[model samples]
Target: MNAEREIRGSYWLETAPGGAPAPPPAGDVSVDVAVVGGGIAGLSTAWELARRGREVAVLEADRIAAGVTGHTTAKLTVLHTLVYDHLRRTRGREGARLYADSQSAALRRAAEVVADLGIDCDWEEAVAHTYAEAPEHVEALRAEAEAAREAGLPAEFVTGTELPYPVAGAVRVTGQAQFHPVKYLRALTDDLKRHGGTVYEGTRVTGLTEGEPCVLETDTGVSVQAREVVVATHYPIFDRALLFTRLSPRRELVVAGPIDADRAPRDMYITTEQNTRSVRSAPHADGTRLLVVTGEHFTPGAPGAADVEERFARLTAWAQSRFPGLTPTHRWATQDNDSTDSVPLVGRLHPGSRHTYVATGFGGWGLSGGIMAGRLIADLVEGREPEWAGLYDPRRLASVVREGGTFLKNQAHVAKHFVGDRLPSVTSPAPEDLAPGDGAVLRVDGHQCAVHRDDSGQLHAVSARCTHLGCLVAFNRAERAWECPCHGSRFDPDGRILQGPAVRPLEPREITSH
Candidate 1:
């Protein structure tokens, strides 16, 4: 395969096409609970609430499960790449135990749902490994294995056997899983509907009025009144609690293709090495498995970061070299918000919030984290107290001090981009200098403009400023989108919002082609 060939979109979405499109709300709507995203977290929470006899409604800006969840590597496990060891030190033994128990419980709940619904989502039980290639990192792997086992997982240190190359050491955990995420979520959506839960696609909630009954205003001028609201829009579109300060957005590239089942590794694997290489496979046609490899994490649109195309190429090359004769057939990118404390915020939206709640900062391990968020959020909304709720509470302040170094590092990165992007020296190519199918941020009449030249030589110009926080947008040439490095707001070349914390599109700017 040509290394420069543009790869197809997500395999899960391609294989499991969504059902008939659900039209946006025609007018005013009312529900007992309103969920503001359609990914795993939101859909899971809605399904749980609907099962509990709550009148639930899910509002999605795009098709359900077609966003980050669709692009995930789809590993369902309690082992999150040495997280137990880190939590054991920072949050204590009890904290690590709670983390493990919560994640394991979530995984069990997912299994029950799959069995109960009789959903054929290619569910497979397998082992999970956190491996290290460097000899120096072997001790860390041993510590992680011990920590994970102490935290109540079936974990042990071992030298991995499956990969083509040898690893110095690996922390292996059994009883984990991998599956087809889209298929699983689609079935869940159908079940939610069966429980009288309403899902409105293409309905972007732009405004929220907090009161006895929270009022959510959609972009189409429809109002949704609900007693409780859950903002699970990945990055938390409404940031009244200033989550942006604690959460940093990371973008990673994925490359996958079919490999003979006999040749593929049977277990899921991840490593902090090579910027984070996460490996997993799912059932495919003719006794073949789709070998999925993910890595090359970077802050979206961060200045001086490597080019997106180069990143994709590097990831693809790494995958092919690691697994000889493995040809990549599909490639896609996914973004996740990493909380400073490395725990997801899954409860109240903020301290002042009464009827509103939020779930974000899942980092890169959203599959299990999302399921955990769903159960926790439902419990909170129903006025039931779960023992592990405080661990993921958005209001927890003690982590701020323990994890202050990470917090400061992320904030400093964002602060640099926020302030440095405006410097005159940080120039973008002129519109005339751009070739077809290229984009740049150019200064036009004292305004920073995001300009893209299409294959037909037509230039589309929009304001360079991101609507979320006035941060300058950078062009991701491989994806052909303007991405905000600060908060992960993504907009198409034509100025439409793709992903967000930003509810509005980039403003169109008047420009002249030379």
Candidate 2:
């Protein structure tokens, strides 16, 4: 079978000790709270609601964490790439402080959740590091540290003697944390089941009907009736009229491999480079593990590997140059929604959609934001006002718009794709042009089409144009599927829709060889 055809595969949570894939929702059911998308966010929210004595049910298109959660680097930290100063300047000092406070509280709350549940997920309290190898960016690091201090974060600046290399400074966040995301989630999911929460995998939510009692419909001919709904799908499962245009999608890469424990920094670290490098180590069954990674602000359908194979190769070479005899073992990549503003959007879907709530735009730090979103969303579900509600409201002006970049940058992307498709093809690709495990866009009879060659050398072809807006879709090596660089509509290699904004699959383009 073609790899792209087989959606079933391994997820970290599904591989955990004594872990079982969440069963699909069978037939119809009614529950007080119907949670859509069984990732960390959904599971976390369901568990929280269940513990509070609510009848909760979760529905997922695949196993838990099989989506973005399965592909995360699992770095649990408050330092999310030079965000403090940026937030301070844009959203104000109070906004920055609140953002920092929310993340810190989430970190502490995660520790408490792990301990209270006694989940053996390799949980540990590790220091977090934000460094700059470029001397020019050292002041940015210093300013971030100052902002962190102002935000009430326990952060300090370090330089020279502190780093394995470089002349600039670094910010060390003490008492930050790290863990095996799937393992920790496994424990929490089990508790959710025990608390009368229902979890269903392989259940895809197709559309939502808004009313006093909202209805969530699944493609499997099952419907969930609930007073409240939580869409924890990495991207909002449905479109928000205006918010959709505000947040842009960013793709990232993460590679895990062997490292010399004696030489690697004891803490996890990230830098201030444009396509930044994040260094982190976790205790695996073998020894200390290293995640050499890159990728930020990538257009979804753009040409590239999600893991930034080139960047990872460079970072690994640098690592081995400094600390020899280490190699990468496991590698993967994922994309997350980056909102116009740095903060996530967590609240009612829109002003009038009172019964439905959504948690999205974690950027890349979905762990902390996921926890915080679960808390805030659950509060809204229970008819209670949450302290962090205003900070994460989706209705707020986008950071870019507020800062005067949204109009130009967004128009640039739209116009570039809209007109760029008119340009000539780089090359006219034949069906035989693609080797096994390869895919490309080809001009077939004056029309562009997407073609994929499976490992078995079977060629599958579909319309290259995205149904949503006619933008060309690109092959995503990380997800092993076709994605739209414009609006992030994703389809399986065979052209079946996996995500939306594009409601139809690309029609198969018949191939005729010369």
Best model number under lDDT = 1
**Which residue pairs in candidate 2 collide?**
257-329, 301-485, 340-399, 341-399
TM-score of each: 0.98, 0.90
- The parts of candidate 2 lying over 4 Å away from their true place are 1-15, 18-20, 160-163, 286-297, 303-312, 315-319, 398-400, 418-427, 467-470, 477-479, 497-505, 512-514
Clash pairs detected, candidate 1: none
Candidate 1, TM-score vs. the true structure?
0.98
Over 49-98, each residue of candidate 2 has an lDDT whose tens digit, in order, gives 99999999988886776777777767788988788998899889988888
For model 1, the superposed segments whose C-alpha errors exceed 4 Å read: 1-6, 426-428
> How well does candidate 1 score on lDDT at residue 325?
86
